[model samples]
Target: MVNMSTSQSNTSLSNGTAALYPAAVTQRSGGETWFEVGRSKTYTPTADDIGHVLKFECAPSPSPRRLISVSGIDVPGHLDLDGRISSGGTFTVLSYNILSDAYASSELYSYCPSWALSWTYRRQNLLREIVGYRADIVCLQEVQSDHFEEFFAPELDKHGYQALFKRKTAEDNVALIVVLEAKFGNHGIDNPGKRQLVCVLRSSDGNIWFTSVFNSAPHALLAMGKVDPLHPDLAIDPLGILRPAAKLTHQLPLVSAYSSFARVGVGLGLEQRRKMDPATNEPLFTNCTRDFIGTHDYIFYSADSLTVESLLELLDEDSLRKDTALPSPEWSSDHIALLAEFRCKPRTRR
Candidate 1:
C-alpha cells in the first residue's frame, strides 16, 4: 500500500482530490500523463502495475491549476552490496546523525525547500530510508530527547529492535543506539560536547566491538597514532585555547572499518574508491551543508577482532549537491548514513 503525504508540499485541495497514477500511465523517462488510477490519497498496487513508475499528483488551486508531482519508490542510487557474506556470523552496522529539527532551519538549509525541511516530512523520509537498509545495528545522533521517547523508540520496536538512548545534558541533541539481535554489552560515553554509543557483540572468535562517534576533533587520529603533534601542519593544540603539556594518545587498536577494508571489483567492492576521500581514505563527506561539507561521523571497530565483508557505497558529492545541499527531497538529513558489514575473525589457538 502506498501512503501519500501532502506535508512536503502545501495543497489547497481536499484529501480525496489528489490522484495516484500507476507506472502504466506515467512515462518512465520523464513525462507524466494524467491517467488516474484512484482519487484517494492511498493506493494499492496491482499485478498489472509491476514494471511501470508510480507517481502521485495534486493540484493546489483550481484557478492557476498548478500540479505538483511526487515520485514513487525510485531505485536507490547506492551500489547494491547484498549477499556478499555467504557464511558465518556476519552483521551490518549503520551510523547516521539525522539532523535535529531545531537545527533544520531554512536559513541554514536555504537551498532546501520548506516542505522538505519540515519535521513532519523529513521524519517519515528518514525512517523509510533507515528501515530499508536493514542493518543489524543502527546508531543515530542528533535525535531529540522527545523524539526518542515518543516516535523512534515505539516505531522501531515494531521492527524487533531494542534501543538505548543518551541525551546531552540541557542539549536538544541525543544519541540513539539500536540492535536487532541480542548483544553482549552496550554503553554510552559522554565527551565534552557529543555522546558516543558503543555496542559489543559476542562471536565465536571473540568480542566484536563497534562504536558511533560524531567527533570533529583529531582525537581519533591521536588514538590511532596516525598524526604527529610536532608536524608543521599538525598543530599541537588544534582548538588552541586548550593546549596540553604532553601529547594525548591511546593504546586501543581501534581502526576505521572503511579504511581497513580493501577495494575490489565485484558487488561488495563496487565503487569503493569513489566513496572515499582521495587523501584520507575515509568517506569523502558525511556531513554536507550549504557552508560546511566534511566528515564528522565515523564507525570504528576493533581491527583485530573483526574483518569487513562489505560496505554501503557512499553517494558522490555531485548527487548530494544537486539540490544545493542535504535535507533535499531525496535525502532527509544533512548527514548521510554510513553502513559496513563485518565478520568476526577466528582466534588462533595457543
Candidate 2:
C-alpha cells in the first residue's frame, strides 16, 4: 500500500555526543504475504549482529520495499526483522488517524462506496494498514471508546502491545448523555468522542522518542517573517492562536532539557497531504468521514539526544488538500499514516 526507498551510510558511535535513537528484510517468492507484523519471522541476526546494526524500515502492504541492507543481514539473502524491545540499532514510531465509526456517515463514505465505509469493512482495512507498519511505538488519534475497549486494545494486545488512551476534555458530556439515553443509541454513543493512543516500546539502546499527534512542525520552518510567508498554510501572525499553540506544544519549556524536532509537510509529496476537519480546520484525516484536507498531524522528537534515520514513503504522495473528496479507493481513511525510523546516536566513548 506504500512505496519506499533506501539509503545507507556508515556513522559510528564512540562516546560523549548523545543522541536519541531509533527494521530488517526478508527475501521470498513474489506474491506471498512475506512479512506479517507480529506473526511472521522477520530476522534472526547471527554473530554478525554482535556490534553491527542493520535498520529495516517500511510502510507495509502489497507493495513493500526492503528499505535497508546493512553490515550483517540481507546482503546475500533476505531475513526477518528481530521485533524485540529493540532491533539491535533502531526502532520505529508510527502516527495514524483511523476514522472513527460514529461520524463516518458523511459524503466521503458514499464516494469510496457504502460497503467500504461499513464498520466491518473499514475496520479490517484499517487494522491491516496499521499492523502492517509493524512500528514499535504507534500514536493514534480519534479512536472511539468502544472501538478501543473492544477492537484495538484487544487486537493489539495479541501482538504484545500495551495501549494507553488520552481522553479528550470535551467527551465528558457525550458519556453522560449516552448513559442517560441507555438503549436509545444504535452504536452506544452517537458521538463516541475522540482520543489519542500510544504504544509503549523500548529500543535496542533504550532511547525513547515521544512522537505523537500534536501539530508540532510550526517551529521547524523558521520563517523570516513572524509567519511563514512562503507557505500559506503554515503562515502565522504575531498574535495568532496557532503561534501560542505552537509555542506551548513544541517548545516544551519544562522539558527543554530534551531535544525537539519535527518535519514540515511542505516538501512531502502532494499525495501525502492530510484531509481537513471543516469545523476546526485540522486535517480531515486519521478520520475521513469528515471533510477538508491539510497536514495537521506532526511527529516531534527529543532532538537533544536522538537521531532519525528515515521517514519513509508517506501515503498519498501526490494527493493534496484541494482533493478532499474522501472515501476513495486509494485510501481507507481520510487521513494518511506517517512512519519514521530512529535510534540513539552512538556516543563517543571517553
Candidate with top lDDT is 1
List, residue by residue over 1-350, the lDDT tens digit for candidate 1. 23222222222323354433332221112232334356566777765455445567432210111111111212222112352322234567887778889888988888988888887667767877777788888877778898887778887897888977866553222223232332322211111222222332111111111122223234334335443445333343334532342344555466666664334434434455556775675777777888888766666665555556666666678876778888787787888777877654432323
Supply every candidate's count of residue pairs whose N, Cα or C atoms clash at under 3 angstroms.
Answer: 1, 46
lDDT of 2 by residue, 1-350 (tens): 21112222312222246411113222122432122223333655444234443434332233342222112222222222442222223567777666667757745355456766667557756777778888877777668887788788988998878998766442121110000111322221222231112121111111121122222223222211133334333343333444443342323211110111122234332222232233432233332333443444444444433345555453332342223455544455666676656543332223
Q: Which residue pairs come into collision in candidate 1? A: 23-53
| TM-scores for the candidates | 0.60, 0.47
Residue 247 in model 1: shift from native, Å? Answer: 8.8
Q: How close is candidate 1 to the true structure, as a TM-score?
A: 0.60
- In model 1, what is the error at residue 272, expressed in angstroms? 2.5
